[model samples]
Target chain A: MTATTPAPSAPVAAPEPPVLAAVDVTKHFAVRSAVGARSVVRAVEGATLDLHRGRVVALVGESGSGKTTLARLLAGFYTPTSGEIALEGVPVRQRRGRVERSYHKDVQLIFQDPFGSLNPLHRVRHNLERPLKLHHGVRGKAELDRRVRELLERVALTPAEQYADKFPHELSGGQRQRVVIARALAVEPKVLLGDEPISMLDVSIRLEMLNLLDRLRTEDGLALLYITHDIASARYLCDDVVVMYAGEMVEGGPKEQVIADPQHPYTRLLVESSPDPGRGARDRDALFDADADGLGEPPSLIDPPPGCRFHPRCPFAMDVCRTQAPPRADLGDGRWARCWLHAADRTITQENE
Target chain B: MVTQFVPDTDRPDAGTTSARRADGDVLHVTGLTVEYVTDGDPVRACADVTFTLRRGEILGVAGESGSGKSTLITALTRLQRPPAVTTGGSIVFYPRDGGPAIDLVTATPKALRALRWTSLSIVLQSAMDALNPVMRLGAQFADALRTHDRTLTKDAAWARAAELLATVGISGDRARSYPHELSGGMRQRASIALALACGPELVVMDEPTTAVDVVMQRQILAQVLRLRRTLGFAVVFVTHDLSLLLELADRIAIMYAGRIVELGTARELYDDPRHPYTRGLRDSFPPLHAPLTRLTGIPGTPPDLRRPPSGCPFHPRCPQRFAGCDTDLPELVTKGGHSVACRLHEPTGRPDPVPDPASGPASGPASARTEGGAS
Candidate 1:
């Protein structure tokens, strides 16, 4: 059941296996076209990601980039059309039975809207207690009360009793989200998949929520997959960053390396598009005007461009990009990018020149 | 009839002096107040708000969810429905042709109808709501144009609609499609084009780019700047994002709990914000390039407007609050171009010494004479 230990000659210790991993996962949704013909929406393709204990990985992209679909695949909401999801090195089948229930025990998904997630009719105490009873089988009244208070207090809802009996409507947006987090914690899951958790929060309170998540990761050794369209927030919280564009992982690496020196054109565009007041006013017009033609909307997933999905909008797209998908170019230190400009054989030298 | 609603411009405390009236000012608002009347006490949404917009200038209003930014916009455009009423104010909009300024609050229904798309127009956050779903995009534009100018024929209006669509980077052919046919970014751009259909002197946009992604937001903002330069229409843009405002707005106003706490040029608000709330808001957005640091966001939520805090609405959440802040309501005082409504920046009867502006939250009280004297 254990992984084979590394050799004595190896300097670094063997890292623990990822708690959750999605290998070459792809999802396709079928729909009827306007003309009444069957068609497939290629939502996600070849999305590979891993969430390790105490480490945070950010899946960053815009709307229609299939980041949510990838998260759902990891959470077992959708059965992947191809590839597999493995938990703790064991492959998981997407069947609706005991296997799925056990998988749900180890993983949880937090949605964007806290108001919609929690039942308005139920009290906060009932919300937190049901998960504990179902997941851990704690039946006694006293035990349930103690555990519920602990969950609320862990999320900084002080005194716990004040909030336990309140309905979801009585709480503020941030408080409601904290209650949502408290409910997620009651199950004591090892992996948390947050899909735009803080995007709905007020700007003045978003950092507090991020800090809380970071504290949870450090204290409980939980693996987190943070999905968001905002790159700035991802940089603030994640240990590693993965950039997705048009249902593909365009670039990924350690947070500092990938964000500071992005290799893919889409990643570069994203990093530059994030608003930075330090850039000041003088160069703003130039920054925005220069990319006017290149700022095309994301392609339709139903009939995406042939080879590289980004080729049509990419400024540096070559003939090969239009005809053939480029292989991953290694940027060293575990950083890589899917781009023709970085490919070793064809255009790297020309790009440098 | 409109002259009856216009306040005496010669009044000493009108906030609009003869110099400002004669200048290139496009819109001047003074003592604007809005309230939401419930069965119980009325909830004041906008309290004595005042500002002026110059020709081709961009004024950004930034605040959180309940801070009344949207209410101010509704009041400014005279678009508020029942339960929301503008209790007091004068919104004087000056025509570009050197005509006498018209008071929007008191303009007749016929006069207001004449000015809706010609002198002032609005763009909302969701383009789908602003645009007609059943009508073709070209038809919508043509309807707006031909209605405003009765002399224009349908064919001429359609041609102008295509050109207007082209200005926002949408292809002329796409004008035939319906609102639901285009992408989200394209639909938003079409709304902006529709707002500019009559060449209005002022455009009031409430979070126009909030629904789109950052790349599209940048493109839309860039087009707005370009169009402003060519068309010379002033803008009043409202959003909850301070960082976006810093890059796009010429001047910025920070609102909290139905009042403007700070107003200054973009550079002033970014570099030397006097109000503690402004500083906290600016820091709440994590920097993109600066070395990462742990930021403690402002601790408390915005005050409830129904039972607002005694003095300053932000004092409960402000880290630099003092004993006097609980009782003394500070008036907005302007010095040079920057204005703030914080006791920390006020000059008279100061209980505590002013803290240094450079040293952020932890800096202890220093001599009050430094920046207080400047104000």
Candidate 2:
């Protein structure tokens, strides 16, 4: 796939059609301030990405970076103020009743908090069976019973009978998370959107969930859009990586390239800041202070900084960076970055590196 | 009273004067047990926990949800509300400025009020609730300060509050604004500043950085460490992130099912973990610098504290569990400063057993693998 083909803008040669694609998707919300002044919060600004079948694309960013807003946009929960989200090359339209049911079946979202997502009042069997009946019309006591047990077993919640009768509060954190995953899979969605799925889980059991997601991608051929702030886990579970800073896609490419050789300054700081114990005897005090004066907190979305939204925190801001937005710089071989430092016309200075 | 299992050898921190009890020991917790007095049954939230905090040293408590990390902190500070009761053990606070060691568990209400902010303080997990929404940041700081030291004038308290806010990298002027006006990072910084208002000898922080972004989390931790070094105070940093503790803490205690499963220095646990659960936790998260490899996740869930496992709490999910692990409880044995309570690390049969640090995926132990291959 890495033939190093030359292109002026955009990467990825489109080896296969995207199962789900967002073309320059933008979502804005009008928020009223304490002063009664109306302003539009540019939560997601013109972000474009694609999810290919059987592949995992990770959306990496800090809080208020609009990564969650982007996922919600893809889930058809929010209508894009500007662009559009398409599934299998067809634009998704808002409809009533059963018409939206098929679209919901095609795309499923797994939330971060397992405890809040599941219903505390209902038993585990009902949680899985409700989705199955609503989506697939699997009726009758026997049919519902079989499908419910199968869903539980699919998520490795066994013995299935024991877990099926128990309430959500009775299950462990890991077990509850598994049940959530099972409910998501009950609909048999081709595109699975998970927002920080394992962040709330324990370290000892986080890998189990990741491996389960990876297996689902291979066996069920599901396309995954994994969103997380943890860079190491993204590289571990994903094939492609997208780095977003303040509602803008800064750098993205194959997971290895983005993680191994990060181009954007923000991406570099994120990779360096993620704690890794195996690195051995690092002078941490000095390392923490090195980036102290580099970048400020994420700018306000209602009135974000002009030009490159990251310029305020970006260590290598320039006059042009303050004045104009940077174009996507094509690094070829499916690798690209959105920073003025990588612009072809700009003269590369020592400060840029 | 619960039967306490103390480490059976001399600690590695015994040599340094800073590690000695007479000079630098700030807090000593022994056989601490806490239970939630529910209608059905008393649930053991924390059991038989023991550890020592040295002056200016950061002791991290790492565990998953339901592991009683939060319960331990709440009980140690004598802040447990109704429905939660400390059933056993004691917490002794050794004051640094030539004061008698006070027992927190049995202290009188008057003594506790005197000790609240002057000698001990807490940085609550959520920064939002830590400050009153109706009160301004300056007022919050001033309230804590004046409550402890009524002799200080209001003007003097405000001045100190401003100075403390500045110490945590927030502007002194922002203290006049209400909590809602400030950003999350600023509010968290203010809460930290409020915690340091009285210059307590020991600060108990419960996931202070979990609410913010990674960049801000690192910044807050760096600020905390800097403040600790300058103020000469110890810290009990509690969080679910073991990886973060690798760089932040001098010593770490890994908790599982209400018990401290392993206690050791950061380097010792990271390099040569003796407990299977500790090894599982170490390998669970992928390292940023290391080559990409499949991780081995520990299967099963944390035991129900109400009816915890009979032997080692981690035995059911342990990848290398043997007969003794499920039946006979392993006492915590000390090797230098690192203490582990697993059958493999027990000194009964094996004088020297090779620890498999390699994170193999769901595949059992090396012996099990070889046996399977031969069969």
Could you list the iRMS of every candidate? 5.9, 5.6
- Candidate 1 docking: what grade? acceptable
Per-residue lDDT tens digits for candidate 1, residues B208-232, read 9999999899889889988998999
Q: Judged by lDDT, which candidate is best? A: 1
- Please provide TM-scores, in order, for all candidate models, with all chains considered together: 0.93, 0.91
Candidate 1 total steric clashes: 0
Worst 10 residues of 2 chain B by lDDT: B366-375
Candidate 1: where are CA atoms >4 Å away? A1-14, A345-353, B1-20, B357-375
Q: Count of backbone clashes for each model?
A: 0, 0
Cα error, candidate 1, residue A212 (Å): 0.5
Q: What would the per-residue lDDT of candidate 1 be over residues A1-353, giving only the tens digit for each residue?
A: 22121222212222767788887788999999789999999999887787888778899999999999998888899999987789998999856777887888899999999989999999999999999998899999999999999999999998899999999999989999999998988889999999999999999999889989988988898889999988878878877789999898888887767777888989988888888776655665776673484468899999989877899888888999999877766666667788888885532311110
Which 10 residues in a row give candidate 2 chain A its minimum summed lDDT? A1-10
RMSD of each: 6.0, 5.7
Per-residue alpha-carbon lDDT of candidate 2 for residues B292-312, written as tens digits (9 for 90 to 100): 556666877777787888888
Q: Write down the TM-score for model 1.
A: 0.93
